[model samples]
Target: MVETVVILGAGWAGLPLAHKLLKYTLPEAKDGLKVVLVSPNSHFYWNVAAVRGVIPDAIPDEQLFLPIEPAFAQYSSENFEFVLGKAEHLDPEKNTIELVKNDGTQRSLSYDQLVIATGSHIRSNLPFKPIGTHEETLAALHSLQKQIDVARSIVVAGGGPTGVETAGELAAAYGGEKDITLIVAGDHVLQASHILPSVSQVVEKDLQKLGVKLIRNTQVKEAQTDNAKRENDVAVAQTRTLILSNGSTLTTDLYLPLFGVQVNTGFVPPSLLDSAGNLALDKTMRVTGTKNIWGIGDVGNLEAKQLTVTDAQIIHLSSALPTVLTGDGGQVVKEYKPSSRKMIFISMGKKYATGQIGEWRLWGWITAYVKGRLLFVDTAEGYVGGKHLRHASM
Candidate 1:
């Protein structure tokens, strides 16, 4: 019988791993390996484009959905399969996985090996969900587009990378007539990155030139939308036409909270994680205490930020998996090596971005063109064997 390798969550990490395993997996082994990718989404989302899509004239919706079938064709083998379902839980001991389909049906699958790559969820307490789910995100974008069309005030909460990039793209799209303000509870934006000092300085300058107001060290206590908004800061409450955090009141037609991201691991067993609720992994990215189980990407917490870090990790693990499949103990007798990792890449707009890589601060349009412009939407589609879609207005 052929051995099955099941990968959960076909997002950033799972898709690439399935592709590599199916393409490069050796067929010589009598156990002929089968690779299965499980996820509810038939298409992989190039999430980076969500922010840029806020602009009415930006990328179109048809271009975003990269159907998974074409990408699977690149492997050139029937050993690969796509399971359309949500992973309900994982059982490493039994080497089985539970899944729930869209129609409320449930099933169990046995696996010889497993990979967990379910990504994280957006974090916001504003009674609104993150702008990732297709329906919710599109609704938010449409609302913002309408606001922009009417020349309304735009207020973006949070000053992290997502917030900064979102504000920049929105400002660039609407031009100066769009009243934009970024409210950061922290002292400066991009503070989590090593490039914060210099990059924040330059980005701040650019934002100022673009007529964006920066409110620093201010926490927004309450946000209510009605005929008017009433905002309350620490020890201060005021009713005005528009109000935000930091004991200040300002009117804005649109309010977007880009505060933080929440990880959805409820489908996974708590025992699989460490004290911090992160998967415990060996140097080779295998689940420390579970045999034939591997964890990659954000769920793995592999000492790298989620995003592209998951890509490199998947490559690193997938390249070495063949050895394990053929080996006696199912472990790579030789060591595994990780590919080069890019530290951080920030997209300012259509054709502009800045990033840091191993003590080097790089600035250019290459990153934006390669990633920021379409967020690899067409590329992902092409990889998945879907017809290439046209680029949306940058």
Candidate 2:
């Protein structure tokens, strides 16, 4: 029997891993291994630029979704496959999983090896991510954009990367016209947590220049949206309410919260995950005590959750996996250590950004040219075979 390697969730981690595995392992015939990518979404989205999508006219919904089919077309059908489904349950003892399709039909897949890369999802609905088909995602983006378009005042909760980028993008696009307030739970934005000190300084400075009101050392206590919505049982709270933990309140037309990303690891057993659903991972990205499985990307308890870091994992896996699968395939013999140098890029709209690689800090213009401009949406197309969908706006 030709052993199959099953990958769940085609997010930042799963998508690249799937493509590279097909490119490196299957085509080269790594012991006749078969690879299958299972995702609920039809498109392998570029989440790196998802924050820009909230701006009224910044990023079109069409540009984000890349057809996964074209990216791995070179691999023969004999060795590669894609499944549109959600993993409902995993029976690790039996090495089989129950998957639910779009129609609510269930199917069983038995894998010789399983890779769980089902990255994180923001709890609040603010157009930071699309949950379903391309049409559904398009509608979601439009709705969120509509909220932003009409709001006279906006309150953004969470000082993390997503909230910072959202505030910058919105401020850059509609600074003078709208009132934008950024509420950070820490004294300084970015908090330089898992990033460089210089990056936080530059990003906060640029945001201040953009006229963003920074409310430091405060956390959101309540959020109430007039146009509240619920989709797929996920509450699109807009993270509104404008209530602060300090007992102050500001009534805003729109409230966007960017923290609290829920890991799609409900299928994972409780014993394997922390209270927050984060998996305890070994040096080799394997779930602790699991012999035939590996966890990657934000799914693991890594400090940095950038796209570049996720890609680095794929590079390591493309080299390490072959040895493990060919050998005992029991204990993960391959080792991977995340780079000690703190690397990050915080884009402040298309004209400016702040990024640091190790001790090296990049200027705003250089950061803008590298990743701030278009938020790397252009470069992302290259990763998935550069397939341009005509239906997507130019």
Task: Give the winner by TM-score.
Answer: 2
Compared with the true structure, model 2 gives a TM-score of 0.90
lDDT of 1: 0.68
lDDT of 1 by residue, 6-122 (tens): 888877667767766765574545678888888777666666676676567687766655667667765545587777778888887788999897567998999988888776665
RMSD to the hidden true structure, all candidates: 6.0, 4.5
Candidate 2, residues 28-137, lDDT tens digits: the string is 45468888888888786776787887776777665777887777777789888888888989888899889998677899999988888887778875457656655676
Q: Give each model's whole-structure lDDT.
A: 0.68, 0.76
Q: Pairs clashing in candidate 2?
A: 223-240, 224-240, 224-241
lDDT of 2 at 381: 68
> lDDT value for candidate 2?
0.76
Q: 101 in model 1: Cα distance from truth in Å?
A: 0.4
